[model samples]
Target: MADSTQVFAILAVTLAAFVWGRFRYDLVALAALLASVLLGLVPADAAFLGFGHPAVITVVAVLVLSRGFERSGLVDLIAEQALRVGDRLILQTLVLSGTVLVLSGVMNNVGALALMLPVAIRLAREHDSPPSLLLMPLAFGSLLGGLTTLIGTPPNIIISAYRQDLVGEGFGMFAFFPVGACVALAGLLLIVLAGRYLVPQRAGQASLDAMFDTAHYLVELRVPEGARAVGWSLRDLHQAIEEPVPVLAVVRGEARHPGHTFHGHLRVDDILLVEAGPEEMALLEDKAGLEVGPEPPAEDGDGGGDEAGTVDTEGLQLVEAVVRNDSMMLHRTVGQLRLHNQFGLHLVAVARDGGRLNQRLRDIRFRPGDVLLLQGGEGEIGESLATLGCLPLASRNLSLGQPRMLLVSVAIFAVAVIAMVLDWLPAAVALTGAALASLLAGVLTLREAYQAIDGPVIVLLGAMIPVGQALETSGGAALIADALLALGRDWPVVATLAGLFAIGMLLSNVVNNAAAALLMAPIAASLAEGFGVSPDPFLMAVAVSASSAFLTPIGHQSNTLVMGPGGYRFGDYWKLGLPLSLAVMAVAIPLILIVWPL
Candidate 1:
């Protein structure tokens, strides 16, 4: 056992580090763990064992299974069907949010949010509604749904595992679902009825078609005497140019061939009538030695208008795209990737989740899932993005064929979840099997499955597990629990539960939810023991509170995911979230008492 002073010191430092925001919670946990080891509080051999714990494996497996659901397009199909049911804003929110909430109860909340986000974006586009109003509700719904099931959120799983260790039995698969369902239903009703009034209305009213304007321009590329373009028709050039831009016309020997009739083969002296603007022309000229044709008149504007009311379509075009996690272009700095030199497009502004980029252009290391506002020639932008393994924001012309293999993917996932839940197989083995099955079934490729996992989150979790164990073994949790008990000796059990819930919620705002839950669960358990009550209620409180992170962008992945797309401000979350959180507390406290009696 650690000395009281040592335990207090550790708790203080951990809390301070968590609130600082300068260091990641995982690193802080690791640091605390190392301190405990050096202080002789935890055994060295057992220090790193948390990485292999069941909770960790369960979380990872859930993430993988979630990815399979996404790749199979099952979620998208559901979203499409739901949207076709109505056009009323309130009705749409009710249906979409309710569906996501129900799905999240059975799957990972993060996965549920990821699956529903595109659908929400599509709905916002269709209704001309700002995503801001809809996204927060969806994020809240996802969080609420997680409260309903053991596997809904990582924090819930961790708390359940901790309970099993302490009392020799943990919550059953649907043990908390009744309470969670009521809470989710109440919250969903509040959002659908009055959420729009609370959440700010900031999404501009712009048609999706009008928002993404492409600048068209004309330029000429010279074909070497022996190059592939020497004898190819203008239609042949279409395949060579990258996406976002297509050749509209061909100019050869002073005669401009409209794209529709330009089918003749090219000769050695033929100046291939290429259609590209300054940016596209510059890239091709530099890369393939293409020549720029005479500049077109400034007023024939390809549609880009300046602040001075002059449209200069020939000059440049601005486009916006959200960076997908699967994008190969992530993590590379613009200068290192030579975005302009290689792709012929300039990186003007980078919007991360929803935060602004005030940093120097060279200093920004592009993260996966960042939204970018790019500027360049319209014709070449799409092609450049394709080369970078990115999908355009605009709908693709490709058709979704009948997915005959979706049933196989679904069966594999269902079996994996059953095996893990039933304790017949390790969670990791089940998920790995599911991922492999997805690849074999052609639902997603091996490369796609690998890309589905978020590396940073996995690394952060692995590195922090040892640290969380150190805090537990070092008696840090005991010290904090004792302090809370001292302050509320005469308070009711419900009050104590509420205090624990509030503390967990506050901590989650600053630190990762998993780390917050791991740190707080033991403390809540200690408090329960001090009061001579069952720890189950307290543990449930911690689970629900840790996952209800609606106050800040950094608190939850779902919140961060919608930031850039919704164009929300930092303060916007609290406007809707504060009341919602309070309501959750009011409803959840009573539910916890009734569901898990003290």
Candidate 2:
């Protein structure tokens, strides 16, 4: 017998702390673990064992493999093809959702979603449609797709590892595929048919003429005599100017090459056809010691220029870009990163979460959600933006760099997954080897590998494992299971399974899904024993429910990520999400009973 009072008290306090949200979940979990150790609820020697658990290794391995797939640009290639289908809104949704579902089954759903997002935005812009209608459906599709495989989501891995510890065997690679596929198909159908109605139709029609906005200015630069520009051809000058601007034309006295050649040679008196705004033109003139020709005529209402041909400074404009979570510039400060010195762009202002920021630009640490307002010559800014991993407010031409080491990255990742699946090596060893190989082969740097992993999630998992073990050792799980069984003595096995599923779903919404699964699995087994039935169905029910957290933005990282971009309020999610959640519950309960019968 266990002291029920002490166990319940600890449980209450932990749940309260999680709901508070003031402290980090990992730190709270660690505090709980230490408290348990002090109370002698868990053995001190066994306290840290969960950090070395197989589930953790499997999760880490899956993350690394997902990163490898993303770096290969295979997902990007697929998304580009999806964009070319030119399907109707309904048909486009079906195609995009279906593609993401299939791709996510083979790779990480988050990676799949990230690759598809730009395509979704592009489609929305093409059709003059609101992204609100498509983005939520895509996010839901990514979540549903994770059900198709064992390594599809962290919850699945935790459940499978837990099962192995209890029953001496784990789920096979395709164990969950049949039922999961059915659920995913049904979910996809619902979103395709009814999702449009659920989402607001706020997208008004856009004019064809206004499709491409000329927010950037176009100006011409002239090469001066006895200057560096005099000896350089347009192509050489374009390459030498390491800014965002491009050389659009080359005017040589009476002759002009509108379709400029990159290899064209230069000589004295050659009028270099260069395209740049005032800022870049100024920079070029200063750097190469060249001079500009007479300025173009002023507007009808504006006063004429001075003898030296200076234009109004008011014509210059600035644009802002929000730094996305996936941006390489996330965590760097403006000065440390040297945006101005290296890229020839100046940071004028930054906006965070819709609020104007006044922090010193140099001292401001860049986070994923921060928006930067920059002032620079528009042409050079666009090209330099690529090197900084920043997306432009307007669509600009992009250069797809050579995908060197892509094949080596794929091969190494394949070997790691194969080694783990074949039981030839531990998953941790395989993934560690693959991460190192990627670095050695120059597929990803060590810094990039670290950046790819979600630190908060890892910490939450590591800290909560010890706390979950404490709950089990203190007989908390058994007590809760017994109480539930007593209350539902007359209920059918399916009803008991449903109740367990509901509890798991609730717990996952509040805490981390892996932690919820680890804490609930043993209790589910105890409940099955009390009812004199197989525990497999009940455990599977818990597993599915734990991973199905679609109600709130905070329930999943994907939900949180789309909140800002989709312009969604906290309540907007449950409009479509509530129905989806209920549908999953209704379908999943029956499927669990049919597939793994009690």
Candidate 3:
């Protein structure tokens, strides 16, 4: 009883930490593992072995292969081509969400979602809706797709292993298809029609134009020769104006330094990039002797940009690009890259951590996922960004991607899936081989592959494994199981399955689904034995319930993965998730009863 109490305390604290978000999930999980060991709930020696567990290894491998596939441009090519499907909102939701659903069955759910997310975002913009409208549904689709196959998700794989331990034979690859497919189709239909509306319209740092209010606020002012602004400090110009026009950058002779109202002296031929309206521009021009120069000259399919920053505003255009995880710009300051001198483009602003940066643009280092606002000739900006490994959000073109790398990555992934399904090699071993092949083929760099692994998710999975075993060993799971069974003891067989399913869904929503599954599998088997029925129905109930954790972001990694990109808050999940979970339970219970015959 004391051991059970300690395990419960440990888990309670872990759940609170996961929801708090004050600490990273990985740290919270590691703390739980240490607490379990110190409390003697889990043996010291077995605690760290989860790092090498098949599930952990497979997850990391899946992450690497995901990175490889992303670099290969296979998903991009398909998504680009898929643009022809239709432009209507309903048609787009079906195409993108349906694609994710199918892909999740064939690859890691998070990985499949990763490939589809940007595509969904593009489609959302095309349909004139917020990405929030699409991402949550796509995330849910990934979860539903995982239900259909043994290797589709970790929960299903764990359930299969438990079945084998109990009955000498496990579920085959397609054993889950009947129930899972039914549930998935129903969920997809519901999300297509209703759940999409549940997702809120959140405007975040998805575009640079939005970040700077560029359409109305940005303007260029030049200090022509013999102008009074050439003799006055930029600070003086700021003090003279009634309305504030924030200077974005100063384009000087052959060099552009980030501009500030309090820094540097304006010279003849110097151009100031500022965010202001025509009224504010007239105010600045009247007070500071600045002229609103004509727009820069236009360039045609070439890297020409008005003779190195002196040209009128004809050829220049603003672009928003994201620093990809594999970008060469990672850790390098904009000044170091000499974007103006070397790339012939002006670095107007960068958005980091969902906040706009207007000061110290040059010294600021680039990180993956940083959104950059750039200006130059269209062709030059595209070429320079491609060389820097930056992906332009404004344009979803993949013409610059390597076709050979794409083919090699797909071939390697195919071999890995075949090896896992045929049982020639374990899932971990097969995927590790594929990841290595991806590295050798130059589909992903070693650093990029390492970064691809969601460190917190992997660590959380590793730490939770031992804690889950401790729950069963310490008899805490039995404690909960006995009470729940007592409540449902006299109920009909189907009611018992429903009771177990409800509890599994609730627990999985509060904690990591895999850990929830691991903790409940033994208790589920205990219930099936007491009823003198095949454990298949109960086990299948636990499996589906655990994977159906849609009520919160913490319940599943796929949901968490999209939360930031979709700009969703913690509370936003239940808007769509509650109904979806209810729908799953409605379809799953009858299907389980009919298929397994409790």
Candidate 4:
């Protein structure tokens, strides 16, 4: 009883910290674990054993394999093959959402979403609508798909293992399919047939033509005599700066040929009408000793003689590309890439959500769905794009991924998945083997494999596992179960189940999904004991509700990811999400009772 008080106090402080959001949730969980240990709630010898838990190992391994899937180009291959997906809106939504749903079940749903996001944009282009119209459905579909398998999501994995501890046997890989499969199918159909109508069609992504009264990052600089830029051709000077900044005009005594010119020879005292971000503009002043303020054209020849003949643009061309999920440049800025010095390519302009940027190039972080206007030679730019993992947006076809490696990666992953399903090895062993195989098979590098793991997520699971065990060991779970029983004492058993489901889902939206599952699952077991029924239905309900966080972007990482790319307002989720959450409750309760029995 004293132990219960200590554990309850620690959890309350932990919950408050999470809601405060001053620190990350993982840090909060870790602090709670440490607190529990100090209070003698969790044994010191077993304090760090949560790090070795099967669920943690499986999640880390799954993340590594998800990276392999992304790098292999196979997921992209599927998305590309679905190019002709369908014609009408309903058919298109069905085919696209169904594909994501299936893909989400096998791999990390985020990876699945990343692989398919470009395809969603392409589909929106074909349909002549904003990406918002399609992206929300895709994001929601990815979340729903996670409900159908033990390894499908973190919440499901946690629930399965908790059952394992309770009954001395865990759920099989496909155990969730019996009921969750039905819910997923019904939810997806509603998304296709009815839910889409609620999604607003805001032009939130990749519209480069006159979308707004955008910024004109126009600045001017003058080339000084004896400067490094003097006597060099315009092409040489342009190449010197890399590509984030564009030279709008080369003014020599007002005899400029073209204002938005690509290349020309530089003369001493030449005034450059530069249209570029502040970083590049600063670079021009510092690197080339160019002075501020535009000057009149030079007193020399008109320089209009060559017209299009003098500047050699045969190999060099401007390419427009959109950042993909696997891009190294994701969340990085132009200055970080050193585009001019490293790749001889320059970022001319970047357009996001059909508008220009107001932030300086150095300050603005790159995000997926941004359309970058690049200037460089064909070979150099193409190689750079491949290295950066960006997809060409224009009609030009440039393949940046290695399709040949896809086969090897799939085989490596399949061996592990089969091993797990067939009970040939534990999930952790099989999946850890697959992650190592991915490295040995050359699907991904060791550094990339390490980067693939979400450090915060791993820490959260490790810390929360011990915290949860402490809660159960101290009878806090039973106490909460008694409270829940009191709340529904006069209600029917199914109604009590419904109340638990609502509580779990509401908590999930408020907290992290895995945390919700951990907190609710044991209470659900106690609820089952109180009602004199099997705990399977209650556990299943907890899993379902924990994964049903659809009311807000903050609920799930996937939803938050789509928020920027889809250009959705925070309140936009409920337009479709509210109905979908209701549908889950409407469908999941009956399915759970039928599959597991009350």
Question: Using lDDT as the measure, which candidate wins?
Answer: 4
Per-candidate TM vs. native? Answer: 0.76, 0.70, 0.73, 0.76
RMSD of every candidate to native, in Å, equals 7.4, 9.5, 7.5, 7.1
| Candidate 1 lDDT, 249-300, residue by residue in tens | 4556676554434568866655543334445555454544445443445655
- Misplaced by over 4 Å in model 1 are 1-25, 205-304, 307-333, 336-348, 352-360, 363-370, 374-403, 416-445
Please write out the lDDT profile of model 3 over residues 24-112, one tens digit for every residue. 56788899999999888879989898788776777788778767767788777767765666667677777877888887776678778
- Tell me which residue pairs clash in candidate 4: 234-264, 242-340, 243-346, 243-347, 244-347, 252-297, 252-298, 253-297, 253-298, 254-297
Q: What's the ranking of the predictions by TM-score, best on top? A: 4, 1, 3, 2
List ranges where model 3 is wrong by over 4 Å: 161-172, 196-212, 216-248, 253-395, 399-407, 441-443, 560-572
Pairs of residues clashing in candidate 2: 243-380, 244-379, 244-380, 244-383, 245-379, 245-380
C-alpha lDDT of candidate 2 relative to the true structure: 0.66
lDDT of 4: 0.75
Is candidate 1 or 2 superior in lDDT?
Answer: 1
lDDT agreement with native, every candidate: 0.68, 0.66, 0.74, 0.75
**How do the residues 241-319 of candidate 4 rate in per-residue lDDT, one tens digit apiece?**
6544556456678565333343566777777655554566667766677776532234322232321112222222566
